[model samples]
Target: MNKRFIKGTMAALVSMLATNAFAATEVTVYTAFESDILAKYKNAFEKTNPDIEINWVRDSTGIMTAKLLAEKNNPQAEVVWGLAGSSMALLKEEGILKTYSPKGLDELRSELNDPQSTQAWYGNDAFFNAICFNEIVAQQQNLPKPTSWEDLTKPVYKGHIAMPNPASSGTGYMQVSAWLQSMGDNQGWAYMKDLHSNIAHYTHSGSKPCVQAGMGEVAIGISMASRGAKLKTQGAPLDVITPAGIGWESEAVGIVKVSDAAKRVVDWSISKEANELYVEMYPVVGHKDVEASVANFPNVQQKMAKMDFARMGNERADVLKTWSDKFDGKSEAK
Candidate 1:
């Protein structure tokens, strides 16, 4: 609570926070961004804030969310960057996140602002569920193309599908959350039970299923639309199918208020330059004027569910538990 401490004591995340002889302040940042982009983000941010350096602690969305909740009393991270908005909402609900309005907040889409704590969190981009159908594998196996969520449950697709485990992935959680919201809880649970029968295995990483599908390891992969689109462009004989309507979540940022440097990072996270970086991988960004685009990615602006991130955050624990109990048997070796 006291902010009088020097470099190493402010945010509780600085293993190397320094004010000694021009040493840069190290801001501890927890993130779930894909591994390839971490260095780019760090380099760009440090270039802009030469006095402050980022100390990144990265993990999957579910792991990051659990870690933040676990460390709420003595938070190890000063900021959370590029995690699911629903996960950010959970942190906000637990009061693990601190409030700070960024510099370019007005330039971002109003709808991307968190309904629960606008000052605490804002989205950078959206990622939604998609079906990765391997044409080569399907042709070999005589599988019919699946066009909807229900189509995934047919006997023909049994033991041929791969998906992420919700307990370990935000994409998995959003898919489950979306089904419950769209199909109603009773039907949703029933739907999962049926779908579980067709699943060959569940992956730990949200990106893995599509990668596996692209490699012909699995005929179908329940994975993110962004990953699917990228794989398709790379000449993977895969169909990146965005279902008629599907679940989506924004990768968002929030502050932990351990130091002024943390606030600076949050500010940079929402800037126009940041949006430009985000849009290179994600087709939709918080910045309204950025005109986000992804090559070979389908138009999904109208297909996203009216997600209630607050509700998803609030219900996360219960939902994960139920999902694990019902479906963890099929998960790949962690």
Candidate 2:
């Protein structure tokens, strides 16, 4: 072969290898999923698309939402994997999310998808407020198991309650919002006032309250149902309880307007595999066809009230402010 031709062939080989090396896509995902489930979700997605790598930033729903909103102009996240729909709605309202409906949108519950023509988000799963009672502590204290939301306000439970604060936690905010809608605004605030007196502390993360209760830091925690059930299965002396009425919100996913890779990820987010993964964690998945077990909160479907999506979105800030003014600085800070 001619020396120049041989050299050109070698160069072509190197260029080809470099192009292949740079072909893999990296999607930056912001999420509010628990620390334990993060790895599993990442692994599952990577397994199916080995060429695509996920860079995840995980935190509580409220914190994640705040972080995303702060970075709106020079947005950092490629996609949001698991966040509150209410938070997503707020982002959509701000026009930060890219308008793209995934392929599986028709399969999801109508209430879970974005209302606008350019759908900004899609729901994955839901979580609701529940009670976590430390059976050992309750037995020792000779405490009776409370079956209603109002039962936690009893004087006997003073300094033995923990719950998330609405200002900083989506789960907390949803529960409060649900109560106000269900019991009427005036009565809900009155009920919360009575309940606040018994609370030991208001946690930063919604599920932290239940974990604290399970660990015996507090006798009871008002938190989401799944977290309490998982803690109990881990041998925490806790029993997960869903009261007669509770507020619920769906975990959702959306594409940030900043990246093409994010748009691709969002396009894939509502596929059958993602739906299956969601059902594994949440019984009432975004898709009605999917079924899974939720051992702790029985009949979870029946317990979820008719939530007004628009109403929640509109009143979120005001409701949170009202809650803060009424209850903030009242609990002992940890």
lDDT of each structure? 0.87, 0.81
Which digits, one per residue and each the tens of the lDDT, describe model 1 over residues 109-181?
A: 8666687544689898887888999999999999989888999999999999999998877778888998998
TM-score of candidate 2 against the unseen true structure: 0.80
- List, residue by residue over 199-303, the lDDT tens digit for candidate 2: 888887889999998888888999978888888878898888787668898888988855656665775677777778878768777876887865655566677
- The total of clashing pairs for model 2 equals 0
Residue range with the least summed lDDT across 10 consecutive positions in model 1: 10-19
What would the TM-scores of all predictions be? 0.83, 0.80
Question: CA RMSD for every model?
Answer: 7.4, 3.7
What C-alpha root-mean-square deviation, in Å, does candidate 1 show against the real structure?
7.4
